[model samples]
Target: MKILFVEDEATIAETTIPAFQKQGFPVDHVETVRDAEAALSVYDYDLILLDRVLPDGDGLDLLAALRRAKDATPVILMSSIRHSVAERISGLDRGADDYITKPFDRDELISRARSILRRPAAMSRRVIEIANVVMDIEARSLIVGGTAIRVARRELSLLEQLLGARGRIVPREAIERNCYGFDDEVSVNAIDVSLHRLRKALVDAGARIAIVTVRGIGYMVEETV
Candidate 1:
C-alpha cells in the first residue's frame, strides 16, 4: 500500500522512509500541510502518517479538512509534544484513526499502521485469498498452490494493488501512484517491466492466476480455469 508521511524532522524521515520502503510500501514525504494537501490531491494513499505540527499550521487542521470533505483515508496522528490524554482524545475526535507519540519504535509504528489497515473500516485485510493464491500482507509473502514465491519490492506493491482489487481492473494511473514514491525516477516502461517480471515469477511458481493487460487502459488479476 502507498503511504503519505507528513513529518518534518529530518532524522525521523531519513530512518522511517527507508523502513517503510523496506516493507514494500512506497511513501511520499511532505513537510508542510500545504505540500501534503497538494500531494493528496494528486495521489491516493492507503495510509497517512500525519504529524500534529507542521511548518505552516497544525496538522490536525489538515486531518479535519479531509474529514470535512468526507475522505476516509486511515490516518495516524503523531506528535512529540502532544502526548497528553486530552491531546490524544482531541486527535481521535478530529477523525484520526489512531494517535501515536514520537520517540516510538519504528517496528511499533509499522505494527500500528498495519493494525489500522486491517480494521473493517479501512477495508484492507491482513490476508487476502483468491482461488488458490494467498497473500499474507503482514508477512509480505505470497503463496500460490502451497508454494512460496519471492517478489521484488515494487512487484509486491503492484501485486498488492492488483490482488486487492480481487480480479477487478486496476487503473494504470492508480498503479503508477501506488507503486512509486515522489522521489523515485520511474522510467517510461517501469510498470510494464515490473509486471513482466512479476508474471514470469508467478508462472515459474506454477500459479493458477493470470495478470491481464487491458490495452490502452490498465490491468487485472484473474483466476485461470
Candidate 2:
C-alpha cells in the first residue's frame, strides 16, 4: 500500500512513517498543506492520512480540493480540534472517510487504515472462481475444477496477492514485498521460480486459468480465454 501523510507534527510523522513502512507500506510524509498539494500532484496514493489542522491551511480545504480534482483516494482526518459532533460532521462532509482524535493509539490507527483500504467491496468475493480455478479466501484453500491442487506456502501467498489484485498485473517487486517481509533474503529469481512451479502444479491439475507471463513486466492471473 502507498500512503500520503499530511501532518504538521514532526514527532507524529517521524513515528508513523517508519511504522507504516515496517508493515510493507510506502509512505510519503508532508508537514504543510502546500507540501501536501505538491505531493498529490506527483504521486498517486491509496490512502491519505491528513491532519485537520495545518500550518498554512485547514485540512478540510485540501480534502475539498482533492475531491474537486476527482482524486477519490480515501482520507482519514487526524485532528486534535475535533471535540464536538459538528466538527466530525464537517470533516466527513468535506470528504474524510473517517476521523481519529488526537493522542490516538498507533495500532488502532493502523488497523483503521488497513480496514479502509481493504474494505469488503474493494476485494473480490470470498471465493473467486475464474475459469475452472477456485480460490477460497475464507478457507485458505485452492481447488481446480473438482480436484484439490496443493501449493506451497510461498506459492499460495503469491496467488493470493495476484487474486487480490483483481486481474491487474502485479509487479515482481510487489509480490516479493507482499510475500516476504522487508528483511527476508529474496533472490532476484525467486519469484520466477515460484511462478514456474505454481504454473506446473496448476497445469498438471487441469486448472482452467493460467498465470500469464507479461514479458519483462510481471505476471497476471486470468481466465484461459
**Who wins the TM-score comparison?**
1
Cα lDDT for residue 95, model 1?
98
lDDT of each: 0.91, 0.79
Which candidate tops lDDT? 1
lDDT of 1: 0.91
Q: Cα miss at 167, model 1 (Å)?
A: 3.4
- Candidate 1, residues 68-146, lDDT tens digits: the string is 9999999999999987899999999999999999998999999899888878865555688888888887778999899
lDDT of 2 by residue, 61-162 (tens): 999999898878899999997769999998899888999999888888988887887667445445777777888754457998888877876787688778
lDDT of 2 at 186: 82
Poorest stretch of ten by lDDT in candidate 2? 176-185
Worst 10-residue lDDT window for candidate 1 reads 118-127
Q: How much does candidate 1 score in TM-score?
A: 0.91
Model 2, residue 196: distance off in Å is: 15
Candidate 1 off by > 4 Å: 123-125
lDDT of 2: 0.79
